[model samples]
Target: MINLNHLNYCYRSGVNVLHDITAEIEPGIHLLMGENGAGKTTLLHIMAGLRYPRTATECTIDDVSTSLRLPSVLSKVFLLTDDMVFPYPTIAEMERYHAPFYPNFDAALLAENLSEFGINPRDSINNFSLGTRKKAYLAYALALRTDILLLDEPANGLDIDSKTVLLRMLSRNITDNQTVIISTHTIWDFQNLFDGVLVLSQGRLVLAEKVWTIVKSLAFVNSLEPISNALYLTQNMGRFQAIVPNDGTLDTAIDYVLLYTALHSPQQSIITQTVKNAR
Candidate 1:
């Protein structure tokens, strides 16, 4: 488990990024959603021990404070940033140089990931395109077999086939011992894969709950006309997509996109009140 206790970050120029954000994330696939400058990347960087908060805060993964950046903590957490650069000429060389840092690095799994992604380990990584480089790094990151896997916009630069392969690999390879936290603006891409939803707004944690719990608390309804008491509504193919309070009989699967929109909409009070009562 990873814990973020009253984290507050700022830059050298004194521009505050994150507020007193606190959340306890359990083992599973977690979707971190927010707007462009909502501090998602900052939070991820702090969790990876790449950045430090201005105030003394607690960010720990399994009792080890991430701020320490010790070998034990570093080996257990892997963060794949959006803008990644590989200096190595080939995948094999990169593997040989960095594999020693991770005790559980699986060379065979790396090869398998390369094969699955249709990438040749002997090919020069510098010559690859942005999407290809992302694939290469993703394979390497997954093969590290770390307990905490943090990915930032992992599906950004990929074709349809590559995205499918990524989804397949994540669905099949994630073990119970590992926790995957994905920070992405495109939440609808893999909504069903997430076990929990975390939404941040203006540097604060606005919503955080298990997907099942959210689904149980609210209902996603589609109708030709607007619902009389919808907490949030959007247009879709001549119909209205709405979020209504679950009355214990509705079993609608939560539309994460709609939930995100509702969290940011003017009528957000309905959702906040209902969620509070449900809890």
Candidate 2:
């Protein structure tokens, strides 16, 4: 498990980016959602043990504190960013140079994932396009076999077919003992992959709940006109997508976009109240 308590971070210019964020993430696929400049990347960096938080803040994975940056902790966690840097020209050379850092790295799995992404393991990495580089990086990341995986904007450079393959590979590869946190603005691309949702707004944790509980607490409705007691609404093609309090009768699938919109609207207080009441 990962535990974050009173986690706060600031830039060198003394501008706060994360404010007292706290959450316990279990072993599962978690989707981290936030608007631009919402501190999602900053938080992911902290989780990856690349950045240190404020003095009073504490962040830990299991019993290990990430701020320590010990080899033992580093070996168990891997962070994949949108912009990746390669020191070697070819995939084979890169793998040879970096594989030692991760004791659990699987070369066979790496080759398999690379092949699935249409990337030749013998191809030179120096001339690869952004999309190709992302694929290579993703394949390497998954092959690390780490206990904790953090991905930022993972689908940014992938084409449609590559994205589908990416999703399929992720779903098939993740084990029950591993925890994966994916921070992305393109939530729809992930669709039904995440089992939990974490939302950050203006550097604060606005929502953190299991997808099942969220769906049970709120109902997403599509109607021609506004419905009474609707928490939030979005117009689409002369129709509306609305979110209302779940009354145990509506079995609608949770619409992440609509739920996110409602959390930022005037009904946020009632939404929070409902969540608290359910607990």
Candidate 3:
């Protein structure tokens, strides 16, 4: 339900944030992964229709790309950042204000989520803890039932228990028609949460493929010397790990974490065209 073709973007200072990028997305959980200053959030902002590129990027949703900023488009796209202040409304007042904007907004669901988090709607947002406010925002965002939900660092600043709760709620509540996209640096938290992985390197699209396909194209090896034509390699606790071409000749399981480390090494970046085109 999303498409970005030949996208290019830069800041007014002429600092290039995103190079030419092309990507397509369907309805599922897509994990956007990148290091610091890798333009993951920038890409999310562009996709949310809040920020526009200086040049044409050819972004489309549901076969339509032009009308991105309209309320109709905004209604289907929800961007959740870390700066939610909850406005000046008490929980009750906030719901009343947002009720008309979201056609599918469910007050009962929001209440249930708040109850699960042990949050009281009568309390003022300023008085609530940071985690509590985040919980409230999460509940409200899910209640909106937007077709595309953009979450930037959704798992940050939450307790371990709350993170688990967030995961469970996401698993249970997200509908089939919805497409959830999360951009974060800590990939370990996902732990089988992603249907596909979108990897960005140096402001360019590096990889976009299903995790299972990644498992097949690359294999983890203990020594780089034994592998044939190693493209990416890394050292872990004195042991070497490498990403090797999977020609179906070796029957071994691919360790993704190890492969990712090798693929993202700064000294020797090796996101080959062959590997990127695997999808």
CA lDDT of every candidate: 0.87, 0.87, 0.75
Estimate candidate 2's RMSD in Å. Answer: 1.5
Candidate 2 ranges beyond 4 A from true positions: none
Candidate 3 error regions (>4 Å): 55-57, 220-230, 247-260, 266-278
Candidate 1 Cα RMSD (Å): 1.5
Model 1, which residues run further than 4 Å from truth? none
For model 3, name the residue pairs that clash. Answer: none
What lDDT does candidate 2 reach at residue 267? 80
Worst 10 residues of 1 by lDDT: 52-61
Clashing pairs in 2: none
Clashes of each: 0, 0, 0
Q: Flag clash pairs in model 1.
A: none
Clashes of 3: 0
Return the candidate ranking by TM-score, descending: 2, 1, 3
- Residue-level lDDT tens digits of model 3 in 160-200: 88888888888888888888998876666766677777877
